[model samples]
Target: MNWHGLKAIYLHEMDRMRRTLFQSLVSPFISTSLYFVVFGSAIGSRITEIEGISYGSFIVPGMIMLTVLTQSISNASFGIFFPKFTNTVYELLAAPLSTFEIILGFVGAAATKSLIIGTVIILTAGIFVDLHIEHPFIMMFFLVLTCVTFSLFGFLIGIWADNFEKLQVIPILVITPLVFLGGSFYSINMLPEFWQKISLLNPVLYLVSGFRWSFYEIADVSILTSLITILFFLSACVLTIIYAFSKGYKIKN
Candidate 1:
């Protein structure tokens, strides 16, 4: 399994986080605080509750998911992309590590970082709102699954990217918008009946729906559908990563 090689790569990525502690950790924390301040103050005044949950509390899961999703991709993508950018990936490829070990190290560390950030944001959110977890186990399961799934997706982005700008493309142009529109800040029920059905087409809706369900026992979609959606994407990302490694796609370039 090349445990030593895996540990080395894992530690290297973790060390990078330590070096950029402010950007990697604190920045997200501050941004989340601002979201609470702006949204809780400006929006909370107008809408007190959604489905019996306070406006502030209602958005916690969505807020956490938003940060975790973007950060997971950014961290994992940059972790591998930097090595490729600097031509250090060939050295790692030539090392004793197997493909699985390499992926485990990078994706595992990225997931860990995102999880930590997500947890911290949760704790931070508690200070502003009264929080409850009807399904703590389910909440954690969704959290872990989201982190790991997106981390793998980020790994693919790392391999596919040829320049630094490409790294920001998906997260900015695609993911962020999906999250904002995906029942994150507000429930899809608030939308018109037709738009509610249209919201279902956005993949992030299922994710936020399921995650929010874990917290409040409420969701825009069925929990089963959300779980299935996550698992399907996770499997797809894993298979894509395998194919990329086998083909030596961007790695050998």
Candidate 2:
């Protein structure tokens, strides 16, 4: 299917990432590094370990997932949003690329960028703490799955947004807060029993739990549940995108 058109769009998005190296790459890296420094120093001093893993090491998976999720959304959203903002989306729409091919290019490029940033952060984390992967293949699986799922979600955001403010709204107001409360820096087990049950309502918990499980073989929830949760969201995003494309939501208007 329209492989050439797909490659063109993919390369265009990837090239923009190269051009915006600082904002796209360095900014997130520095911000996540700060989380490690602050949390590892101030909080690590008080709490030595969670579930037999060192405080500094324990947060690595969560921190990486946090960065991946935000970066995926931001990268994919901006990748497509800029085309719409510049009135270039119509040109792409008029091209030979089908909806699936267009999505493949944009979302694939965005996921690639997020995966790169996540890998960098993981390497950066290793310098500060001793790290281990109980299951390296599983770790990679969860990493790729998270990037792809959230990239699709971000693509939806791109199509739905009408302005710059709308682009920032969900990530700022909703996602970041969910991550903080979703067992990123601390285990949900530390919470009161009632609150622990309450924490389950936050979807990000499953993400962090599953990713963390790949690392230490310990988790707040079962790996199966986490896998299912991400898969469910991924499928939902896929269906929503197809419907939006068919109905020409935001894109055609």
lDDT of each: 0.92, 0.93
Stretches of candidate 1 exceeding 4 Å from the true structure: none
The digit string of per-residue lDDT tens for model 2 on 172-209 reads: 99999999999999999999999999999999999999
Over the full model, what C-alpha lDDT does candidate 2 score relative to the true structure?
0.93
- Per-candidate Cα RMSD to the true structure, in Å, reads 1.0, 1.0
Clashing pairs for model 1 are none
lDDT of candidate 1 vs native? 0.92
RMSD of 2: 1.0
TM-score of each: 0.98, 0.98
